[model samples]
Target: MAKIAGLAVGMSLALGAVATPAGAQTIADLQAQINALLAQLAALQGGSTTTTTACSFTRSLTMGASGADVTCLQQYLQGTGHFTFSGGATGYFGSITKSAVAAWQAANGVSPAVGYFGPVSQARYSAIAGTTGGTTTGGTTTGGITTPGVEGTITVTKNPSPASGVKLYEGDSMKTVLGIKLEAKTSDIKVERIRLDLDETGDTASQDSAFYNKAVQKIYIMDGSTVLASSDLNSSTVVEESNEISITLAGMSFIVPKNTIKVLTVAMDAKSSWDSTYNADSWTVGLATDGVRGVDGAGVNQYGPSAAGVFTNSFTTEDDILDSATLAISLNSSTPNTQQVICELGTDNDECDNLEVAKFDFKAEKDNITVTDFVLDIVRAGDTVATATTAYIYDGSTLVGSASVAGTTLALMTATFSDIDWVVPSNTTRTLSVRFDIDDAALAADTFVASTDADDTTAENSVGNTVTATG
Candidate 1:
């Protein structure tokens, strides 16, 4: 059809050129226009002239992959004289397509020439197809249907701070594990699907099944805090072939306009409880180079970079620390304790009893916690540790426990009051007052500092699970 129209236009131009007056318009300029039109027509008819064909190849094609992209590859190869098969552009990559690809690769100086149309071959073809005249050293014009609108290109950059070496404890929900940035170059891009490549290390077949069944609760594609799409990783949404997992986002509507960047985050929710003994394993998440499926403003499918080793994020599963309930400890804000105290001189070096030093408040979440031990550290300024002889822990007016501050060193001493066995009910706070007994040998400005830190106190929940305090 294009050739017929070109022929009619050329005939009219020829007749008009002959009938024109000599001085009205230059005969040379008319002939030049006619010649240029003839050249373009010949290029369109797949002649010796080379012309750029508007076709975009977003995916690497090999044997067995069938799509419009493959058909485009075949048509371009046929025009380049590399594909000589009788059955032309069947839209399926068969043995003939392989042969044609190998020939094209060899002609274009692509190494090895094994007929695998990968990133290197795609890049080389793109370079040739993007040239002004669409002509290369050994190839003629590319023949294919001209795709309408601008040629869209998507660049996928791996996130700089991908979550790595993370411990995904039980009950961890909606944790972002992998991310990539997508930039649309020439047109708006509508991202419809994303493919995740799963790599499990030290995982058995049953463990893999367990992971898909219950370990991973849901996988989500997030834009900041908004969810674009989510899947439960069941058979309906996921297809597993070899080491790759393809997730289908059929109804997703994530769009990246031209000259803009959109961040795509992959997050997953872990089940609150899983069989740690059976399903614990390290897993790495990545995007398959051709897995990011989307369409540009022109409604052409776009893919992420086909380069290998671009994205990688690894995480391991571990047993949860808080099994029954959470135990939190913090410095009591309501306590009237002061760090610096002025000791009154009573002739014989000031002796102070029950000097308030530190106060701790412990809370149990959802379960009763019996605090079994409290570890205290006392530092005496400008005096020996013996100046602070004893440290007592009082629950209001009742002395729960006391320890002698004579262990460890002279200036700094550690006092462990064990077997206190103070029970704090669920959702209740337990405040313990820490007091020090200062001997009369201390100077006027001397001070006894008492403090405690997280993980220094131990407690057991109602279900008999031992837990360390956390703020």
Candidate 2:
């Protein structure tokens, strides 16, 4: 797309006739050196020249018109180059004077005699004035006349001068009107709308107004410019519009099938999660509800001693006390023992349940019990059973060890005596304890059944006694 080779220079004038004839030279000194060599070839073909005389001949013309019919066919075919006018002299036969009268009637072999002027174009303007040589009005030598001069006018203002200008390329036929028409494309050619005034400092003229649907196949419009407006947009239904965003026909539907591009992205507020203000009491109030009856104060166990031994009862009152309970503590000694039960509930006073009933249950047996020194005075309680109650130490149901009790004796206590590590669970005969009781209202300890006056049913002297094993 780079062409600029226009350097034409040809000047001539030699008409002779008068006076004492040295070498002659006078038809007014050869028509003033043929109007100063046709005004220096109409200022070097910027355009203009005309003159015509028919019958006895006389011709001189230069025509290459562009706007306002280049001053009306440069004043009608300046130096009448035997007729060639398509645009200038703004007599508007625009299309660069029909491509310079179809390139001067296909370089004079004829046939483009279409519009503007007729009679085979005035008989090819009297056959370019009978062979162009100019001069006559009596000193007659009209043999086949060809004076070819006197038609003058040339005006070319350069700047993409092929008339109305337009040439962007890349798959050209942008829907027609002399084709290559454009609504958008900064890279793949095709573009119009006053050539976007030629890149007005890069986008943002309010984003150039809008109307670009050119049947969209791959449009990115804004700056990255990657247009392919339909070669049937492949890769499964392409529809990529983006001055910031607009996409349709994504995975496949109306057949956008050639090389695909359906991308849309531009809602930038960091990436929107939407909170223009968000209402409806912000999600109504914790949601899921139902199940309350501590003597029915309506929903969430509403206030005061909500049942489960309302005040105290070695702990007993169940409907799954909020669904999880098991608190067993037995300690009967017949001399084959190891004992430790430091279960404390919380509300702080070293917690054993100082009325801070949010939840607790205890378990203890070998939370750290390993006594095997002499074997016989072991009465360890808590064999796997605790949902919450601090004092933890079990091995049969896995808790392992913890006992530090004194937040003021756990506010009011029901279970203390903190430290112990008794391990004697081999041939038990007494000591079968278990502990657990979840929803507490301050220690109402239950699930305890002890037995010691020794009938010796050995499971290690009955660990905490209740011996019953058969399997």
Question: Best-fitting candidate, measured by TM-score?
Answer: 1
Q: Looking at model 2, report the run of 10 residues with the lowest lDDT sum.
A: 279-288
lDDT of 2: 0.26
lDDT of 2 by residue, 374-466 (tens): 111212123313223443334345543443322222222233322243444322322323232222323433222212222221222122332
What are the candidates' C-alpha RMSDs? Answer: 17.1, 35.1
Clashing pairs in 1: none
TM-score per candidate, chains pooled:
0.49, 0.13
Candidate 2: list runs displaced more than 4 Å. Answer: 1-41, 44-471
Q: lDDT score, residue 185, model 2? A: 11
Candidate 1 lDDT over residue span 306-409, tens digit each: 86646778877766635647789888997765555654433344655777787889998756888998899877766442377788999999999999877566
What's the residue-level lDDT of 159 in candidate 1?
A: 79
